[model samples]
Target: MPILWLTVIVLALAALGYVIGRRRALASGDGRIRNLHSLPSYYGSYVAMMTGVPAISLMLLWLLAQPFWVNSAVLADLPVSAVADGSSSSLVMSDVRRLADGLDRAVAQGVMTEADIDAMGSDLSGIRTRLGNVGVALGSDVSTDILTSAQDYRTKAATGRLVMSILVLAVAIVGFGWAYQRTHKDFRARNVVERGIRYVLIAAACIAILTTIGIVLSLVFNAIAFFRVYPASDFFFSLTWSPSFGGGSELGILPLLWGTFYISIIALLVAVPIGLFSAIYLAEYAGPKVRGVAKPLLEVLAGIPTIVYGLFALLTVGPFLLGIFGPDGVGWMQAGTAVITAGLVMGIMLIPFVSSLSDDIINAVPQALRDGSYGLGATKSETIRQVILPAALPGIVGAILLAASRAIGETMIVVLGAGAAARLDLNPFEAMTTVTAKIVSQLTGDADFSSPEALVAFALGMTLFIVTLGLNVFALYIVRKYREQYE
Candidate 1:
């Protein structure tokens, strides 16, 4: 049976259990609703939980474990010499899986029978033609060893799935019967169901934490592997950025880091003041009608995809800047693709991020503070500058930091606007690339994963992670210090 059908069967059984459990609880109470300790609905929910949760959990575990068990079983039957020249055991296993699937499809199409496939043995051309007629392509001729392994792989996988379906259904049935038997007027169904829900919530939180840990660990391990081959000192301190697959590549991060921050600083300079001023005007100065109409228009920038921003940078912003500063005019900008273009476009992308958050934070400032400042004979501007801004400073700082992070991590705008030239130059008009752009370049297109060139992507990622983490920590420290002072 397919897993989908099995799921349906378990759900049906659980539904049946719910009905029975609800009726049994009411019957035990002599059909008097007040006689039950908990509600009849609670009893039904408890039975459903008991029937579905355990079976689903078991099925999930079996699904995760089945591949590993079957892969090992199939690998054991594979001959040592089955791995042909310039190929690996993994590659051969891939072929085996493909052939197994093709054979199954051929049988389903009535082009081949089970007995015929079993006896086909070393009939490479014949099998290929039959499989091809069904639209399954094979790269190489089928060998006796591979053919045998495919059959065994198919058999083992089918058997495992069958056993899994049976066990899951059995567990569901057992849970249903057990919970039904326990259904009574005195049974604490509500408590059991509530406890189960709490556990599920706890598990969800733990999964999130574990996922973060796993991502960090993966970065650390790959970075370690990279640094072992490439010098950590050079990788961290060198002012160059070049990667050659063969050897002797100057993989320096400083130039990339400089570009990344240069663009981000420009972005912050553009985004912070405008976003903050707009937020203040909307929050403190604008009339209700204007604010209502204006706030949504400002926030629409946030809803726009980063790719659209990239296209705007490429077609509109980049060309416009170049027209003003390029060789045809000021002779400062050489082409449309330059750091200034990326920075300006990225800043536009971050405006809504800064404005929306700052607006909320500024609005959260106490009305009492504003009134007190007014009572002190301060004008509206003075009150805003001294009272509202200071009160909302911590949250404003947080919003700025969040925008900075987005600016730093932006890839599309940089790729489209800033030309991919890793150089330690000072001119914003000059083209430069960022760490994110370099990471994409290093990993793209026919790159060998084992080489330092490819592995450097991980090291770059880890460096970016550290930089962002430090920024977050610094932001938290600032927020806390100021928050404490105000409190």
Candidate 2:
């Protein structure tokens, strides 16, 4: 069955279970609500939870596990000769999956039948043509071994899905029957349902924690692999940034780091003052009507996609800056793409992150602080400078750090505005590239995954991750110190 249909059927069963359980609870109490241990609604919710949760959970687990199971089975049965020279098993498995999907599509499109597929043993003559008709283009002709494996994969996958559907429906039906039988007037349905909800919440929290752990581990492992092939000392300390895939490459991270920090510093210089002042105006001085109109207009910059910002930097800002700083003017800039271009655009992109967050933080300062300052004969400006700003300092620092992180991670603006020249030049008008832009460059096209060039992307990502993590830790320390002082 289609997953959508299965979900609908399961939901229908749960809804029916809810009505039946409620009625049964009322019947057990002789239709008197006061005689029941819990409310009639609690009994119905308990039944609905029992009917839906276990079955839905099983269905999700089955879906996640099915692909792995199918891939393993197909790979184990696949012949060694199927994988071409210089190619990995993963690539072969990818082709097998695509071919299997194509066969399924071919059947669905009425171009082929199950008997045709069964009879088509290792023949690549017409199979590719038929598959192409259904819009399934393969990189190369299908081999006999690949064809057989795909067939086996399709068969096992179909069988597994069938078994999963049967098992899910069975569990749902059993849960409904059991819950219906247990829905008595004295049953503690509320307690049971609440306990189940607590577990679900705990599971969600664990998933989030586990996901973070998984990301860190992946970066660590890939970076370790990269270090094994390339020298850690060169990667960390060398000032150049030249990556040649055909060996003898210089993989220095310093230039990239320099560019990243240089651009981010410029961005912070532009963003912090403007964003903070705007926040002050919005939160402290603006009238209600003005605040309502101006705040959203300022925040709308945040909603504009990074790509749009990148285009603005590339086409408009870069050219505008170049005209002033190029040969016709100061002659400091050689081209349109430069650090200043990306930094200014990125600063614009980060305005909302700082302004909106800082506005909220400034507003969160206690009104009593302002009144106390006023009572001390302080003017509004003096009171704001001393009391409101101080009270809101911790949150504002956090907001700035958050914006700094966003600046550090920005890629599109850097790619389009900052030319892909990794250098240690201090001039903001000169072209430069960041770690994120280089990460994208390193991983683009048909690069070999096991090669140092490709693996360096992970190393760059790990370095970026560490830098952002340190920023977060510093932000936390500052927040804690100020929070303790203020509270």
Candidate 3:
């Protein structure tokens, strides 16, 4: 049976259990209004939980475990000849699985009968042609050993599926009967259902936390693996950025870090003043009609994807900058793609991040501060500059840090606008690149993953994670320090 059909059957059983349990509880109340300890809905929910949760949990466990069992069985059954021409057992097993699936497809399409498949000799004659007729292509002719393994694989899989279907239905039915018998007027069905929900919520929270820890651990392990093979000193201190998959590559991060910081600095220089001023205007000076029209327009920039901004940098902004500073003009910039172009476009992309967040933060300032400044005969500008801004400083700083984090992590804009030239040049108009761009370049194509060239991507990722974590921590510290003053 298909997993989807099995899910439907389990849900149907749960629904039947719910109706029966609710009716049983109400009938036990003898039609009296206040005879039950908990509501009828609680009894229904308890039955549903009991009927669905165990069966679904069992199915999930079966699905997770079956693949390992099946793969182990097939691997053990295969002889030494199955792994031909330096191929690993894992790769050979993949071929076996594909061939098994193709045979099943052939059977489903009526191109072959089960009896015919069973009675076939070990020569495995015409198997490829028959499977091909059913739209399952093979890279080579079937080996006799592989054909035997695939047939065994299919048989074991069929038996497992049959067993799973029977077991899942049995558990669902048993859970239904158990919960139905326990449902009575005096049972604490509400408390039982509430406890189950609490455990579910706790599990969800733990899953999220565990996922973060898992990611951090994976990065740390891979980075350790990379450092074991490649010198950490060279990776951290060298100024060059070159990687050769063949061996002996100089995997320096200084050039990439330089480019990343230079572009992000340019982005911040463009975004901060403009975004802060816009926030000030929108929050303190704009009328209601103007605020309504302008706020959404400002936020629309955020919704426009970074990819679109990258394109704009590539096609529009890069060319425009080239016309101003390229060799054909003032001879300062060599091409359309340069650090300035990417930075300018990235700054534009981050403007909404700064402006939208700062606007809300400025608005969150207490009205009493503004009133006190006004009472002291201060002008509106003076009041805003002295009182309102001071109160919202922490939040504004937090917003700027967030925007900086966004700028540091941007890949597409840097790739498209900033030319892929990793250097520590002083000129903003010159082409440059970032760690993210280098990480992508190293891992892409037919690069060997075990090489330092590809593994360096993980180290770079860990660096990014650390940098952003520091920024967030600093932002939190600033917010916490001044939050009491504002409150």
Candidate 4:
């Protein structure tokens, strides 16, 4: 059965169980609510939970495991000779899976029958034509061994699905039976249901933590693989960035790191003063009506997609800068796409990150601090600078760090405004690319995964992750130290 159909059946069973369990509890209590230890609804919910949760969990696990099991089985059955020269086993397997899916589509579209497919032999010319008729295109001609493996893959997958449907339905039915039997006037259904909910919540939290661990581990392992082929010292110390899949690629990260920091620092310079001043005005000086309108209007910048900001940089800011700095005037910039263009636009994109967070932090400072400063005959501006700003310093620093991280991680604006050239130049008018942009470039297209050129993306990502982590730690230390002093 299709997963959707299976899900519907399980949910229908759960709903039926809810109604039956509630009626059973009412019947056990002689149709009197007072005799029951818990609410009738709780008994119903308990039945539904048991009937649905286990079956759904099992179905999810089965779905997650099925592809790996099927892939392994089919690969085991496939002979080593099936793979063509200049192609990896993974590529052959990919073709096999595509062929299998194409065949399935052919059958579904009534282009072929099971008998017809079984009668088909090693010759794939006719098969390819039929597959194309059903809009399934293959990269190369299919082989006899590949065809056989694909058929096996399809058969196993269908069988797995059938078995999964049967087992899931069985589990749901068994749960319904058990929970129905347990439904009684004296049962503690509410407590059991609440405990189950708590466990589910705990599981959700664990899943989040495990996912973070999994991401870090993947980056670590891939980076290790990359460093095994390319020297880490070269990657870190060399002041050049060039990757060639052909061979002798310079995988230096220094230029990329320089561009990243250069752009980020420029963005911060543009954003911090404007954002902080706006935050101060909104939080401390603005009337209630002005605050209500201006704050939301300012925060609207945050809601705009980064890609849109990139486009604005590309079409608007870049041209404007070029007209001033290009041949028309100073002759400093050769093109519209330069570091300053991206940096200025990215800084604009980060304004809300700084202003919104800083505003909230500034507002969070105690009014008593301001009052005490004023009591000492300090002016409003003096109170803001000497009392409110100092009290809010830690949170403001945190907000700035968050903005810096945002600046570091930005891709689209950098890609659009700053050209894709990695160079260690001090001139802001020069084109440069950041680590995030280069990571995207390295991983894109038909690159060999095992090659250092391809795997270096992970190394770049790992470096970025470490830098962001360090920034966060520094922010946390500052927050904690000042937080204690303020307290």
Candidate 3 scores a C-alpha RMSD against the true structure in Å of 3.3
Model 4 earns a TM-score of 0.95
lDDT of 1 by residue, 146-229 (tens): 888998988998899999999999999999989999999999998998999999899889889999999999999999999999
Residue 150 of model 2 has an lDDT of: 89
Candidate 2 per-residue C-alpha lDDT over 374-400 given as tens digits, one digit per residue, 9 for 90 to 100: 999999999989989978988899889
Can you write out model 4's per-residue Cα lDDT over 331-360, one digit (the tens) per residue? 999998999999999999889989998898
| Among all candidates shown, the one with the greatest TM-score | 2
State TM-scores per candidate: 0.89, 0.95, 0.87, 0.95
Which candidate, 2 or 4, would have the higher TM-score against the true structure?
A: 2
In angstroms, how far off is 244's CA in candidate 1? 1.0
* Residue 134 lDDT in candidate 4: 94
Name the lDDT value of residue 92 in candidate 2: 83
Judged by whole-model lDDT over C-alpha atoms, candidate 2 comes out at: 0.92
What is the lDDT of every predicted structure here? 0.90, 0.92, 0.90, 0.92
